[model samples]
Target: MENVKDLNHKPLSVKQYAIVSSLLFGLFFGAGNLIFPVHLGQLSGAHWVVAMLGFLCTAVALPLLSVLAISVTRSKGVYDIGRPLGPAFALGFMILIHATIGPLFGTPRTATVSFTVGVQPLLPKNAVHLGLLVFSGLFFLAAFLCSYKQSNIMTSIGKLLNPLFLVLLFATFLLGFLSPMGHAASQTVTSAYVNGSFFNGFLQGYNTMDALSGLAFGVTVVTAVNEMGKTNPISNSKVTAKAGVFAVGTIGLIYVGLVWLGATSLGKFNVSPDGGVAFNQIMNYYLGGVGHAFLATLLTLACITTAIGLVGAFAQDFHKHFPKVSYKVWLGLMCLASFLTANFGLDQIIAWSTPMLMFLYPFAMVLILLSVTSPLFHRDPVVYAWTVVCTAVPAFLEMISSFPPVVSQSGFGKAVTTFQSNYLPFASAGMDWVVPALVGAILGVTFHLVLKAKRNGAVESEKED
Candidate 1:
């Protein structure tokens, strides 16, 4: 067998590895990253730690595994793992990821984060849209310029802004902790983190897209390492691991600190139970008008960086699939699509993302498990396909059942509600995919074993003949 280092031909030194991992971490921790954990802390109150750990597992662990999956399989792209879904499913997955990370999800999110954290502070309610339009226009232009030049603009920005953000964030924590809390009377919603703290945190982490962005970031890390003249598999994994450790560690520290700040602030601020509202309330309480203004600016800048990276990655994927489509055309299309979605506001974005995560995450997890244990299953494509289909069919049903009432008001919604209501598994949670997916996975493995046995028997009979 080839040694582990030989598994990947790319290698890098310790320092290079650290830099790449730090950059990866920085890339993942943008505007949303800053806000979500704080919101969790504020809402969870005493249960914050449990919630934080759950969030970290999905947010940090899943993303890290995505990298590990890619490295272990040495596959050309995401389709390799997702191939069991067939080409059409792969195409759909591409579209979904594009929508989620590029135009549909990530782009609008950038605009929304900018609006909430950055623009909302300085502008009046009516003027917020005007700010969004103007700021987004300028932001995308800058993104286009950076993308065109092919400079590591995001890396540079991350390196600079992450430190600045850390300083400001730490300042927020210190000020809040030191200042006497206004009153602990308004903490009416302290049980938000009670029962499903980790699971909720896991779902929340899905909003980051760091778990999915591993494919693109992997390219970045590998490119950097190759340029440094270290091209060994073991070295490459080490570098990736090192960078991941640094990034996650930084994010973990910030997440914990911010959550604590939010929990403490609950004593003073009568913020809404909603995540976005809580974030704004905390900013206003600490920074005064100036603090709000600073966060808004910072959020806009950070969101832009994320959007550019996402757009670049999606455009590259589009070009790969359809060579006939010019890069500029695809890029323009993605931007336009995102612009339309960005108008929906932050709350809407979060609402829509929920079901999508419920459906996709289980399959993504299964793919990782299968890829890692490829040798155990003897690299059987049939097993991959069967396992995926079984998991996917049920997951898809669950996704359909979890549709927001606002999006569709027809029989489909009624059917979904009816199914979820009657089904023992779906009675409580909005997510019904978990149990069915588990059932399907078990059936899938059993079917694979039977198929293997049948094939062996047929071979024995042929040998006798």
Candidate 2:
């Protein structure tokens, strides 16, 4: 029935489409996106290509899949994705997702990390706290100005910030490649990557944390497509998918380059503790004193675009569900919340948010997969409900296990971990949710079919009678 209403419209021109794609890229590719693939390259060494292939699946592919999931499902935002489960569940899902990806976690982390990596190193140790306060205040002020008008977000990020960033970044890549660090093929593979480079890279993608943002960002992408004049469901899906492909495909290429940069740098530097350090090393090796400024600028550009996209998305989605509160009010609230959190409570914020991320990621992944495949199951409530309940058990376990050591070392935490590790496949690895989700999907589909057949049989008997 929903399929019958897919009207037609002209698609966007090449330039318009490219802008939409750039908006998506600007929204999703933040500091973490830069960090993970480079770290993977360092670890995988000679196997960087193989590792990046798997990394692409979860990093580049998963987010694009989330965008398509929104498009295909005809969901206006994350709120609609879980609506099949029930309005109450859908509302809760929307709030949790928006909160997790909004002020409580991802948004503030961008500011916090940008400060720590780019600006803090320049400040005296005694002045670090004051520096964070000043930076985050200025950061949120800029974010608020950019996103206060929803229409400005795409232009500010896509038409302006993204192109400039690409220019600066590609210049770095060119310099690194042209000069001699050493070939990645000859670098020594770290032990974990020497064995299962692909799997390790797949796991590395989880660190980007873009999948959750992708689901949240459905609102922005769909809004941009709608503004571009393709409102029909079919056309909408097409534009969204194409934009996602361009955005994430470009990201995949960058990942290849970033990882390769890391692997080759091993020629001159030991494996660093994290990608931030490795990235700095690359920049310093090439540009010396000037590289620090370039890095700070890059981090600020990458992160602010992300902040603008997320703040706008949060406001738009919340306003959609609770219209009594205006969008601008919600936007201001998020900016204020994140600014204060970034400046004062960042460590605590991270501790709490890590567990929430672990908890929410599985649900987001399962919901996206199911929404994309719902046609096969006729969008049945049973399928959604059963899969969700089954998945919840392991997801909850994973969340508790990810709690900070003080919390995770509790008796209750140990009990949860013991149960998960003893029984669930890949439980210790934070991936056990996958198998249980599959089982739940199978169970839901089977029961749904059984009920359908019985109802059909009853109808046939009634007709004969």
Best by TM-score: 2
Worst 10-residue lDDT window for candidate 2 reads: 1-10
Q: What is each predicted model's overall lDDT from 0 to 1?
A: 0.66, 0.86
Error of 2 at 227 (Å): 1.4
TM-score of structure candidate 1: 0.85
Q: Please write out the lDDT profile of model 2 over residues 24-83, one tens digit for every residue.
A: 999998877776677788888899999998888888888888988887887778888899
- Candidate 2: lDDT over CA atoms? 0.86
Model 1 collision count: 12
TM-score of each: 0.85, 0.94
Report the error of model 1 at residue 230, Å: 4.6
